[model samples]
Target: MLKKITLIFISLAIILTSLEAGTSKRKGTAGAEELRIPVGSRGVALGGGVVAEANGVDALFWNPAGASFVNKSAEAMFSHVSFIADLKVNYLAVIANFGGVGVFGLSLKSLDFGQIPLTTVDAPDGTGETFSPNYLTAALSYSRRMTDRIYVGANFKLISERILRESAVGFAVDIGLQYRLESGLRFGAVMKNVGGNMRFDGPDLEWGVVIPGSEPGAPVRSLRVPLQEFELPAAFELGFAYNLKVGEAHSLTLAGSFQNNNFTLDEYKGGLEYSFNNMLFLRLGYSYVNEADYIFNSPSFGVGLNIPLGGTLEASVEYTYRKVKFFNNNQFLTVRVAM
Candidate 1:
């Protein structure tokens, strides 16, 4: 079973790689970009290099395959991100594991753009009105431990975006695989945002126009301009992680990942984490792109504390900070509970 599962994932990786080839010309062309935003403090703090090690509810946004590895029967997570450009992101996820069946998860991520001044072509200066953009993604995920060393998972996502009176709805899927070795080495691969193009439609696209050659008293015709569809920002990522024990109460983890984006430059990420007695964690990570135009070029740092609330219940708090270029730095706060 493990062999067959591995083969299937490898085939998918090959197909996705082929599809991503020669896509550089489409840079900055994909829509539904909110899908690319990172959530979960731990994963973001690791520069998104935790694909191989992510577990529990955190894996819902990083690599679903790891979700089945949670030690608890159920888990829940909440996170808030202070993104660049005054954007705010809120994320919530819950997962339940059924022995011998699988792990099922549900997650929601919403972007808060706040309020913006509404203006039309005729009122370019001030319209005295305000509108807020709404972007949300709701996902249902399933994950299973195919074998002692192999895990597989997938997520089905519903995406919605609304701007003023215009809105777009789309769907996507994410598939992931994780393999672990007894030596504390792990490998992960994921294909994310596989879906159809999205096109916006609503009353905002309709306008009244008068024919140029029409005579006097000509009636104005209503025209609804058709909008072009934009492809989703798809990506394929491969990652590796290794854990080393330094003593009875100390350990270290090293993680790295390579990401191929269909609508942007490729990225390489690396992260280091230290843990003491499985209670406290410190992490540092960095990301590199071939070009210098990427906004998040600086290092990321984070810390986490795990507390046992009682029998069979545990709680965790995590915080991360990421430096961005030419913008306010990003920060994430996450709380998690397991029982």
Candidate 2:
């Protein structure tokens, strides 16, 4: 299983790199549209520190390779995000261990736009009501420990989006690797959203150029043009984390990650998390990245609780909050269960 997963990711990496070879290597554009795809709530909280400490289903989003470290028989997680007005994002994931073979995970992320007032040029004359645009992503993931200190994983994803009445669909993949070093330090890398382009195939497609008048008896010819396809917001993230055991009951973790955004440019995020015997966790994180208009520099806070339920049951809840310039506060709530 590990060998197959590695081979698949290797091939995918080569293919994605080839497609992006000629494009301008410029980073964030004026309106970095695809940057809005929030990576993960837990990471967003700890400023994405999970790359090193990741475990359980959260690993599917942070660093799938970490899923191999999960000791639970089964694990599940669900998260909801109040990102902005009319925009809500939600995610659910589950991971199960298969004896001594490896671990498997399934995850889904959906962005919902509440109903909006549909308007047209003919407006009051009214054509039809506006429909909210929504996007969905479903992925299957696998993680394994090829060796004692090396871990790897891969994800196959299905993506679909609908705007008003038009829709488009595509597929993508994610690959990640993590290695632990001495002194409680960890290093990791991941490539995300690598895939082919998608074309909008909804209604309203017209044939041939509509000209006022060409000739007295000239017949208009139908012209077919290739669909306009957009590039995926592909990116690479490299991170490092170190944990300091202050005492028997207290520990502090500091982590930083650099993101090489394919569509945008680059970003830096740093954070710190403190834990009390793994029972209580408090995290503070900050991110810095240039934006077209306003710099999306913000700080995040999170709190977590780990409760042991009898024999094989475990429960946890995490809440994160971040303040973005010119936007309402972003809130994320996630619940996790293990057996």
Candidate 3:
């Protein structure tokens, strides 16, 4: 256990140094900002200090390793986030364990921009047409226990974004590890959104070109503008947690996490949770943003209910309220089923 703990710290130190070096000159270079939003109500309530304690289908958003130990056989979850600008995000994930071998999970996150009036240079505001923008990310994940106290996992994601006639498609991956001690202490680390550049190409960038006197009405050819590529907003995080248990009825947990972002400033998080009989839970958390680039979410609070059903099934429902900068507050709802 001592050796494993030491290794986890050493790995974190290395990653921190690497992240500092990689983000030193790439300040504002990343795109696809929607991918940075945290999913799952429990995670948001903990201010994203979920790397170590992520469980069930919720782990699909944070650390895939936790999914390996999720439930007894199968788990499914759905999440809804009401964000700023009347935007909403929806997530769904399912995980199934394969005996003592491993666990496989699948999830999707989707964003919709509702409807916007379509206007052109000729028609400024009365186009009478509307279009909705779409953004989606689909992932496949797998996790396994490497040792009695160590777990590892990976996730591969496909991202697609479209607006009118323009679209961008890209891919990314996540790698994570989790370590648990006999003393109820946990440690976790992960690297998220590691991918290459994404460039958009569509008919919107193509323009018809015509000579000054070429047939006086017909266009001669078309000119296309090249789109520049942008890097992904990769991030690295380290998390730690410990809990105090009173017999079998009441428990309290405290967690802390550090995030290193390539496209923005680093962040720190602290969270606390109290559960009664593992059925009712109350959570609170705070996030400290570096403010080097911009401000981020501030504080969050949540409540959760876990109920056992007949026929070896259990259900959990969670709700969270997060305070965002300029956006007031955002609400999240999540539901999970395990069997």
Candidate 4:
């Protein structure tokens, strides 16, 4: 436990140094690509409830430290998301117990852009070819309980981005802590997407430029293109959840989280969920984030079903729908199995 704390502090110190140096420049604008990726997931299932009610491998994505409470011998989950336009995202994760001492997990996420039209200065109009941009990340994580009520986790991630023939790759790390106060109350915090800047390297780097009018062409020279590399969208999250039991057949959960955005300001997310006899659940959630001149207000709804598979094995399916402005509503589905 002390070793984990030391590593967390070291990582934070590096992050602070990088932020102080890079943010001083005050760049021109933030890209749309940065705004599009890392869209929050699984929050729709939280439904304003506290952390003790949170369970399964999905918790690793939301709060890695929560994995310490997994009672199942092994767990696996898969989620597919249909995002704005034609973009799609898929996530897979698995975790297991190690002799009741700790839990270790692996997670992978992929974002795919179908095809985009390619254009050139010569063609101006269109090149009649399409380019696809792909983003992928893989993470390995470990979580351990420090006490009966406190837990901690850390993750190491490798990230990559590819567009057409150009690609950039980098690595990042995440740390998290969760505290369970009671059977139905929980608090959690996590720092995510912290790592080194990525640089683009590919065939595109082979292009050359001619200096403007240098003594009537003093031997055409090759010029190295400047690559604009920036920090990942790192952020911190604090959340609380509470569960209320009403009789023996029904329960209500409420959850809320505050996100401190690194590029922009902070955002708030809240949700509510109702479960019936531990067999079915219905959830609704809302989120608020500010853009330059507008607000990206999204509301989501979800449903979950739990099925018994004998010998303590359990299976469940979950679906969530979210409405986005200026685009078709998004949909996500996940399947989970635990023993």
Which lDDT values do the candidates have, in the order given? 0.91, 0.75, 0.85, 0.71
Worst 10 residues of 1 by lDDT: 16-25
Better candidate by TM-score, 3 or 4: 3
lDDT of 2 by residue, 1-339 (tens): 447545754664565455442223454331214334564556788776556667668888877888887778899999988886647889989989985688999998887788777777678655566577778888899998777767888888888887765678888888888776557888677787778877776554546664577776677777654567876777777677888999899999888887766666467788898999888989999887765543458899989888999898989988889887777888889899999
Highest lDDT scorer: 1
Ranking by TM-score: 1, 3, 4, 2
How large is the C-alpha RMSD of every model relative to the true structure?
1.6, 5.0, 2.2, 4.8
Task: List candidate 1 segments past 4 Å from native.
Answer: 1-13, 22-25
- Deviation in Å, model 3, residue 105 alpha carbon: 0.1
Stretches of candidate 2 exceeding 4 Å from the true structure:
1-36, 124-128, 207-226, 290-295
* Of 1 and 3, the candidate ranking higher by lDDT: 1
**How much is 262 displaced in model 3, in angstroms?**
0.5
TM-score of 4: 0.84
**Residues 1-339, model 3: lDDT tens digits:** 768678777977796877753434666677788888888988889888978888667888888877775547999999998888889899999988996789999999998678989999999975999999889999999999777788888899999988888999999999888887778799888889999889888999988789677676685698899989988998888898897897889999888888888877777887899999999999998888755434455889999999899887999999999987776478999999999
lDDT of 4 by residue, 1-339 (tens): 546544754664465445422231323233223322432245554432223334547766766788778788889888888887777988889999884579999988888788888999898888999888888888898888888777888778878788878888888777887766666777666776777777777887676666786777577677666788866767666677787899999998888877665666556778888999988989888876555432347678889888989998998888888777888777888888899
| Residue pairs in candidate 2 whose N, alpha carbon or C atoms collide under 3 angstroms | 27-264, 27-265, 28-264, 28-265, 43-48, 118-130
Off by over 4 Å in 3: 20-28, 212-219, 292-295
TM-score on alpha carbons, each prediction: 0.96, 0.84, 0.93, 0.84
Off by over 4 Å in 4: 1-41, 45-53, 209-219, 290-295
lDDT value, residue 141 of candidate 2: 94
Which stretch of 10 consecutive residues in model 4 shows the poorest summed lDDT?
20-29
**How displaced is residue 41 in candidate 2, in Å?**
3.7
